[model samples]
Target chain A: MRELTYREALREAMAEEMERDERVFLMGEEVGHYNGAYKVSEGLLDRFGERRVVDTPIAETGFAGVGIGAAMVGLRPIIEFMTWNFSLCAYDQLVNNAAKLRYMSGGQITLPIVFRGPGGAAHQLAAQHSQAVESLYAYVPGLKVIAPSTPADAKGLLKTAIRDENPVIFIEGEVLYGHKGPVQDEEYQIPLGRGEVKRTGQDVTIVAWSKMVHAALDAATELAKEGIELEVIDPRTLRPLDDRMIFDSVKKTNRCIIVEEGWPFAGLGAEIAYRIMKEGFDYLDAPVVRVTGEDVPMPYAKNLEHEVFPGVEKVVRAVRDVLYS
Target chain B: MDKTLMLSLYRDMIRIRRFEEEAARSYSRGKIGGFLHLYNGQEAVAVGAMSAVEPTDYIVATYRDHGHYLARVGDMNAAMAELFGKADGCAKGRGGSMHYFDVAKRFMGGHAIVGGHVPIAAGIAFASKYRGEPDVTLCFFGEGTANMGAFHEGLSLAALWKLPVIFICENNLYSMGTPLYRTLSVEDVAVRAKGYPMAQEIVNGDDVLEVREVIRHAAKRARTESLPILIEAKTYRFRGHSMSDPAKYRTKEEVKEWMERDPIRLLAERIYALGIANEEQLKAVDEAAKQEVAGAVRFADESPSPDTATLFDDIYYEPEHHEQDEKVVPLEKRRQQASV
Candidate 1:
């Protein structure tokens, strides 16, 4: 096993995929000459050259549609949004063309493209810059949404997303880029729509994804000291969710708590809570509680920003409430 | 011009005119649904531009794209079937009149979104250049689309990358109801090309020959030099924007004025002046077009609706693989097994 930061793992996944397939190219604002806005694509331009590692203008709608068009003609394009927030500019291309082309074309066309970027609250980037849009993308029927929470998962899931013969929305946590963890040295791939249990317990289940996976893990550790065992599940892929794994965990633990960085209204956790109530209600000892970000524009101040979104304390409290009930 | 070429162009334009008339009738009769933007007056632009490109070249158009699809695919039956939402339609009825796609003919699609398809056209052109293919992509949109951010972005990328794409702006005097002058700051849509440093031209969209000549030049530049060109075709839609629009925004005199310079009548006059054919021959061509359109309607009426079971199909590729749940032990169970 080799240790790599989340940033390095993403770079490796892209670099390896580009080498494996000539059609695979990376295009985005500041992705080439600037290495990357967050340097997640560092050294790719030098290795893959300007052809594959393309630096585009600050036109998300333009470049995102360009990627879709390229994919329409048998090319695999990896479009990087500077951040998920900027992806709003290209929402039509992502939601309309890329998603509907296959279905509209009656299977005559396939859009093998990936729209990936840092998402959710990052420091005090404020309202416009900080948004968790995975739920918005997951609502579309033709899209495949993946939110990887760790370095290994990032590498594995990204590779899988690029190879998948459809439009995929790959959401990377803005804060998790620096987190280092063990990744396999050999070539590997993690299947999309699979949930992985980071820590297993019996009293309660904590289901989280992306950056919230770390929060759930921390809460699990803190709860262990208090003799409250908790099972932590990371749903790597959001759209084709591993529903069985989540239901099984909730049934076994007899209680469930969902944590997310998005707002509570119609958020990922809201959907999960609905599913748990619908399918796993018979085995549940208590109601499924959701720990989500406050329903306000993220604040610029550090303290307010921290309070806006979910964290370790929030996850722990939600788990405690479910366990106690 | 050669008599055969002149007659061919006339036939194409007349075919479009008849097809649009039929589509309008269908809409009026409650056979068609959704927003139907008819290309009644803008036939010359689609016919002329499509004539310049090869069969292998790609084409993308806006919601009012029946003419473009007919020009590219030359399949009147399929086009009508698509409007009828029949399974045998170009898009298998999944895409209504607004989205007519024929991958075999290289007609990308007719996107209903105002300016959304511009970048897609550029990207298709980018793929052509990347793959060393000689194919060029032609993107057609209304003047209203020029005001969208996608227009700027798509043009900038196409110009910057020197992608092989020809952008045609059919300035049909109005975008739905907003007049071009009211919406766009510039008089000539081609003037916006300066921002991208791309070559551009303004052509009389009523003159099919002039439109064809300009598109031919643009297509040549795109293929040989890998340069993108924008051409603004001054045209107008004879009917209201859609079936629902009464078009009271413009005066009856304005409609009459545009009708006087109708694209089909202009081409018919040109054919007569060139001694290609007389009024009788032109009348025969018009008659043929009517028959062709009638046949198309019959085909559409006979075609079956798409199977209900296929409603969920084509949404994703190999969805079965994604549906399967993987077997895995819980973290504690794995740890316990490792300890044993």
Candidate 2:
């Protein structure tokens, strides 16, 4: 296993895929010439040339729909949004065109396209940039959503997404690009809709995803010091969620707390908690709890931003309440 | 210049006219639901423009799309069945009237959102250019789409990349009920293309020959040079925006004036003037269109509604193996798995 930063792993997956398939191309703002806004696509322009590694002007709706159209005609296109917040400009393209083309065409048109970008809060970027939109996309019936929290999952899942025959929404962590972790050197793909237990225990299950997975593991470590063993489940794929893994964890632990960076209402945490209580009702010892960001637009103040976020302390306190000890 | 080509174009325009007329009759009879966009006076734009391009070239159109489908595929049963929401329809009843698709024919889709299909049309052309294919893509939409962000972006990208897509704006002078005077800042739609700095042309959409000639030149540039061009087809929609629209906003005189230049009549007159078709021969074309539309209505009447058992199909492609056929789980599978 070779350790690589999340950004490097993603680049390797793309570079390898492009070398393997001529039909595959990367198109986005600053993805070329500028070596990617975050250097995620660094050195790709030189390797693939301008034809495959295209750089478009700042028009998300334009390029996003272009990618869908290309996919409709037997091309695999990866459309980057720079940031998920900017994806709102291309919402109609995503929701109307990409999400519904296959279903609307009655399967005559299959969009083998990926809409990937960084999401969730990063530092004090504040209200507009610091939002999580996985739930909004997950609620749509046709899209497959993935939010990989680690370098390995990021590479494996993105490789799988590029080769998938459906439109995929790949949400990369806004802050986890530089995080280093071990990834397999050989070609491999992790099947979507699968969850990984980063750290397992039996006292209580702490389910999370993306950046929250790191927080859940931190919470687990602190809880372990207090002799409150915790099971941390990271649902890499948000849509077609790996709920069976979460349910199996809950069936073992008999108690659960969902941690999320998104708002509490109608968020991924709410949906996961509802599923746990619905199917694993008999297995529950207490009500399923959710430790999520407060129900407000992200604030600018660093302290207020931290207060809005669900940190390790919130997860620890949520465990004690769910445990009633 | 072929007599058969001229007559076939004439016959195809009549077919779309008759097909939509029958669809309207069915809608009034409560056979069809949802939004029904009728292409009454704009038949020549589809027939004429489609005729100018090769069959292998891609085509994308707006929601008033039955004309484009008939001009491209012309399977009345699928077209009428789609309006009736039947399983045998082009999109297997999932798309209904607004989403007819024929990938085999390369008639990409019947997109409903205003200017949404413009960029998609460019993307199809993008693929052709990327693959070094000489194929061109024809994109048709209304004058109203010119005001949307997607329209500008699509045109801008096409010009920037020199994609082989011909953007034809059928400037029918109305955005639904809002006239161009009310919605557009500069009423000349072709002038907007100047900003994209692409080659452009304008044609009288009512005159099928003129529309055909203009598109022929544009398509040639697209195929040979991989360049995009914008064309404004000055036309009109005889009926209201959709089945629900009363069209009371327009004066009877305005509607009556545009009807005099009706696309179907203009082509019929041209056929007679050229002596390519006579009263009996042209009458026979209309007669055949009437019979075909009648049969389509019958087919739609006899077709079955899509089964509830497979409602979940086509949401996503779930392939069982690398070279294996993709499987679509039944719609109930999601609900079934959710309960567990």
Q: Highest lDDT among the candidates is held by which one?
A: 2
- What tens-digit string does per-residue lDDT give for candidate 2 at A162-255? 9999899999998999999999988999999998999989999988999999998998888888898999999899987989999999999999
lDDT of 1 by residue, A1-325 (tens): 9999999999999999999999999999999999999999999999989988899988999999999999999999999999999999999999999999988877788889999999998888889999999999998989999999999999999999999998999999999999999999999999988989999998888899999999888888998998998899998999888888999998898999998889889887888888889888799888899999999998899989878878898887887787674
Cα lDDT tens digits for candidate 2, B83-142? 889999999999988999998999899999999999999999999999999999999999
Flag clash pairs in model 2: B312-B331
* Cα deviation of B27, candidate 1, in Å: 1.1
Q: lDDT score, residue A43, model 1?
A: 93
What TM-score does each of the candidates earn? 0.96, 0.98
Output the lDDT of residue B88, model 2.
90
In terms of lDDT, the poorest run of 10 residues in model 2 chain B is: B320-329
What does the lDDT read for residue B65 in candidate 2?
Answer: 90
- Model 2 chain A lDDT-worst window of ten: A268-277
- Estimate, for each residue in B7-51, the C-alpha lDDT of model 1 and write its tens digit: 998999999999999999999998889878888988999999888
DockQ of 2: 0.76
Best by DockQ: 2
User: Residue A53 of model 1: what lDDT?
Assistant: 88
